[model samples]
Target: MSDSEETYKSIAVLGIGTVAAPLIEAGLLANNASVLVITRPSPKARQIPEGAHHAAIDYTDVSALTAAFRKHSVEVVVSTVNHEALDVQPAVAEAAKKAGVKLFVPSEYGLPSAGHTEGVLLVKSRFVDSLVAAGLPYARLYVGGFIEWIPYLFAINETGKFNIIGEGKAPATFTAISDIAGFLAYVLTHLPPSQLHNVSFRIQGERKTPRELAALYGDKAPLVEISEFPPSVKDGAFRKFLQVAFNAGFASTGYDAAEGKDDEKRAGSSNSLWPGHQWKTVKEVLNL
Candidate 1:
């Protein structure tokens, strides 16, 4: 893996074990990018698109990760590894920065970080900051809540019931997994610059009310009424310090009311990234 050998066509994925499978498939589908899949002691592993490079190495070792980047001549680094896989994003970003990778996509395929109001996303905000400081072009794609999978995630199905915020009437957005990979690969191949691309998308699924969703589950779903607890606030000269303790916390009653004005302006995944390109709605996905 000499400096002279890199032709600049490779896209190195730091963790291929978790969600990289679909991303790699999508990247390879793009036809212009070469894939370099990296794993721990890189396994003989599962199937990926043909012509992609595979490496099983010690990612814990910064030098090992760097060497793989150089070996593949990767211009883009997709960080699909689990948070534990790369405990320190700054480290990976530093490696990507040094490797001169033109673009980096961190593992942020969940709900959009910016859209959250309850500070449910406080942890994610920190990671995005780290990516920005790394000094490479990054795209953070937000798929509003997962429409079909949250049941499994929250173990709602086990109880034959689910919990949601307020009257269950809020029209929150949700995105399909396949669509996420497609959108991400499309954006990565079309990297713009050092800025983080922020866009939220939802599947073309009908925005069914919670009752409607629960009804679909039949007797399994209780005739339950779910209510959203408004974002609580604390009144303090030191808002940050007092918030550390929930008992000391008192929500600013007016805050949630003020924020409520924009409740209806839901932003689904916009295919504007690829103008003239159409997206598949949930109906099409379910063959309805």
Candidate 2:
């Protein structure tokens, strides 16, 4: 696909916090996409990245957000705010619809929310629903687990004390925040007629088992297996424990670095943003 900066002009990044801030920064660097940041009117507003338009926003008021979108003439809306997705996401969708924002990217930066069955309505899912219901042009990148959260949560790099269950060897999905934004930039710039889609474009840097990772660094650090119960009796089970976590939302999984279709097309993209652009590896991200 032809990835030309002319495709995206004014872009609004909702909640310039955490990974989204850097993602927007990276996009602004490589491409000429002008960024519009939506931030709460607070002392923290200064944290929004430079080289873009910034607006103080209160997510609780959809009308106010709608005004920001219209005032900025935002062509694309990207939501990056986390934790409060239930309230913020739906509000963003509503405001975008009212303001006639052409494209919307929800806060789903991981597994496909489409497969979850028991959700009365997770925050992200609710915002996703608003996107569908609003009929706003939307796309999501499903780049598996965030490697940043793994080591601490699993106590990797050291082993004596960890919450690891089952053979960590089961291949799992993961995507660095940087990579996710790169791929997401590609999609938002090249979304098709499916205004909404059930399929998620997945990616990952590595998929080694706990045993493999343990073996690699276990001798160098303290590694302790957390559970020894039978798979049937375990809370999430083993053998395919990682897969279950992804499915059940206990741990991140659901996608891997498998050989398949190119990363450019989610539903259909005539011009891909990162066709030949080589992406960073998990190894490189780890080192960084």
Candidate 3:
């Protein structure tokens, strides 16, 4: 089959949150793919996008999820479930398997988590294990960090004071949310099963140090070196851990020396997978 030919005609997006929104609009729906947004039965109404189907199922019930997948003839299952709720993915994988789904894309749009032992990374790793155990073909996407969340990740407050975690010298990968969604939809529709199955696509739109990132804002954002994260921060402990990981260089698309030479060597950024597309940079996105 030609690369331009759509391999998966029916695509089911598991959530309608931050990531799923663009994936449905610019990515899947724009490409003219049959898109289905799957959400848990909610009392509140959801504004599902036009040109897409919506299925409200009890996510905890594997049989119900399986029926929904089968009813829509879903070929690919793209999960955008929040990291905290990733424990529910194993059951989702079971349903996908039972429904004979072609591919399973888990909710792993963050820093590399191959050998993580604790925190949400560990939870994501376990979900991949479940996919393997269930014998389901899967694709894992690692984009380091979303460009839209840079202010929050960098702890840059309203007054433009940037918190310098560690030395703020470690380089980290950043991709615009639109690029992440666009790239995902492109590859899923264009690439064949041999290239898509059980593979990790490490992509980055831009790479920059925290200091450099702050510098992009010029005099508007001043850097403040801090020994610890502020107490007022929401999810302070988790966010602090992520900052530490970024400082240790785990937040880059490329392999870091701190990870040890003996560690499993990861492939370099797969940004070329989507050839000829101009990737959005931090400066461009922030208008800096």
Candidate 4:
């Protein structure tokens, strides 16, 4: 099919874990799109979401994956697999290309590679390189972090507090999982390939610091000092690194590393891209 002829009426998504769950829901909600979740062969049955279809296949096998895509007439493929399964994404992309899929959304929903430490981030960056090298048309969504997991990231349940990684004032991006999924649905059905391909769509529900977040939650959540954080909480001494990184302007999009060479003054948001869609703020998410 020609690029212009490609329309996302039927799409296949790999995995239905945390991030994938909402994406599946959103996709199914698109009245015109038939959303299918691709799972590994049975003996392990997963509860398929209502209004969606499920298929079992050896996703790692490119030939099988391509066949599955062709069978489903999957015009678009979205990979929302977890970080550990990220290595399999390139193969998925390769299969999509072979199957003549028009668009691919890689599994990126966190910090931009520039802000990540080594390991997983490196693998993700390499995946992007593979996409470019293989000539695959893809969209990489960079959402700073999931707001739903923020409370746990800071261990709010046990300590009722979280550390201020940086100055505790920078407006770091955070998107509710539901909002991310909803936005993904909007993009898939509404955006044409010309608007969807080869882009870093940065979005955020709201940007707030630990201190500001504490205010919303009141005394229930307080800001703790990184110095007092337990040893187990240390992400390879990441606290210090993130503190420096966030202040150095690694917090949000619209960052031109060359322009002014200032990270603090940099800011941008794609929330305005879909003006009709309403986003959830941290306050609404926490029910505060």
Candidate 5:
């Protein structure tokens, strides 16, 4: 790609839920990039942002998806589809490759998928393999858990009460949804494809245990431990395993003290990489 084609002037997004919403907002903020979303056909009318574009395509049909990407001249494909729609990622990757998309951003904003037994992680790993095999340029953002989801996952109730599944001292990596979205937008538009490809772009807002987080909330909220809630590996046991997994340090934890600074710098894929931005820690977010 030459200087004329090096920039990602147009982007295609795959979903429009919580994660995708902020991404789309960031895209619209970009000076030269045009945003387009591939939405599923709905019987009722659907709402879309004013400046951003939309295309209803059968994600099952790879050829149709390819045509849509080519028609829009989408340089980067940012997929923010939910876990339930993960099956369509390979097809999306294949279509992006066929359409000559410069970069493909897969929906992998969570824990590292290298050696996890969790079903969701396995699915993510497989999709990443497909991208590598297809020779597509891609960026994987391993943002651990979203801070916004903490309340719902920890069984927090409307009265500002919550429960920890086990001992409340397990530290987990968490990033605010807004920060993740902003970083994605920045990388897709500013970073060159050569640098963005095959990169594990990570950013975490806070790395704290549940007990620490509860303490930050102070008297306004109380935390309880529900020891009876056993971890399970059934179909929808992601949260259960997540609690135990973080407790066991299953996610990528930079390096040991003996490993030295080089490894620590590599492992600490953090917000410091991006300038002029303030990442919110638990204390900052909870007003502790």
Candidate 6:
């Protein structure tokens, strides 16, 4: 396809949560693309982003979803639905296929999920499988952990304690929320279908160990290493699992050392895809 024909002009973004908000902003800033934000019907008012179209429909109702896509002339469907509501995606994918949408971007803005067997990751992996079953092309973005959440993940509270899991030497990837949103919008409106479809774009704003991150807080925060989470920490089990995953090298965007040679090798970091954009780092995010 010619450069003029490669880009998708109309896009419908599902859910306007943490990641979706900036995506809508970026799409609107693209100038050439029309952004449509889709949400589930609710009595509570939603602050629809200015200059973007809004639609509230029953996700289970394929007909309603299909109609919305057609009404907007939506060429791509980007699902930012949170993990708890991910089950609705198969229905959304069906609607996208029926509407002849060109692409579907699944909500996988966290760690690498291709080989997960249990929990939310499993549900995410299965959703991708459903997309394949429906014959819908997709682009999966693996961006490790969000930079803003690092404080919570590290158990840094209002007090001056920094809880470190294990040795805190394992390398982990982190990306700013704005960077993720900007990258998604940039690629969807710029890359050709050939590059967007069925691709896993692994990106990272910075790679740092837990110790390195803790030091950024300066001497005011004292580091305390422990094998298990203290009772003070909420969601102890899940938090413990995350620490273990990090220590085992599973927290990065792509393949890690813990996964043996037999495991699938993920594509390398694709940050270069968006040329000249300076990714935000942890120090910059923390104002250090």
Root-mean-square deviation (CA) per prediction: 8.8, 6.4, 2.7, 3.3, 3.9, 2.6
lDDT per residue, candidate 3, 19-38, as tens digits?
99999998988888999899
* Model 4 Cα lDDT, one tens digit per residue, 1-288: 576755568889898787777777755455468887898787966988888888887768899899888988888898988876897897889899999888888888776653343666668777877887888878877776678876765657656676555466655667888888877777778777877888778777777665677677767776765644566564525545554555555445544433523243233356666768878888788777
Q: Which candidate tops lDDT? A: 3
- Compared with the true structure, what per-residue lDDT tens digits does model 5 show for residues 200-268? 776777777778777776666688676544344122256666776655544433422233211324444
Q: Report model 5's TM-score to 2 decimal places.
A: 0.86
Model 3 bad stretches (over 4 Å)? 2-6, 256-268
Which window of ten consecutive residues has the lowest lDDT sum in model 1?
Answer: 246-255
Alpha-carbon deviation at 83 in model 4, angstroms: 1.7
lDDT of 1: 0.53
TM-scores of the models, in the order given: 0.69, 0.75, 0.93, 0.85, 0.86, 0.91
The lDDT per prediction is: 0.53, 0.59, 0.83, 0.72, 0.72, 0.82
State which candidate, 3 or 5, has the greater TM-score.
Answer: 3
Give the per-residue lDDT of model 1 (tens digit) for 1-288: 454333335688767643577777765446477888776763355565676787776666677777778777777777776534446556677777777777676666654454233443445555666666755666555554344554542235454555443344444444566666766676555534422243223222234444455555556545443332123322222222222211111111111222432232344434456556565544455332
Give the best candidate by TM-score. Answer: 3
Off by over 4 Å in 5: 1-5, 158-160, 228-236, 251-268, 283-288
Q: 2 or 3: which has the higher lDDT?
A: 3
The residue pairs found clashing in candidate 1 are 41-56, 42-56, 165-228, 166-227, 166-228, 201-269, 202-269, 233-250, 233-251, 233-252
Judge candidate 3 at residue 218 and give its lDDT: 63
After TM-score superposition, what is the CA distance of residue 173 in candidate 5 from its true location, in Å? 1.5
Better of 2 and 5 by lDDT: 5
Local error of candidate 2 at residue 114 (angstroms): 1.0
For all candidates, what are the clash counts? 10, 12, 0, 1, 0, 0
Candidates 2 and 6 compared by TM-score, better number: 6
For candidate 6, write residues 36-90 as lDDT tens digits.
Answer: 8899999989988888899999888899999999999999999998877988988
- Which scores greater on TM-score, model 3 or model 6? 3
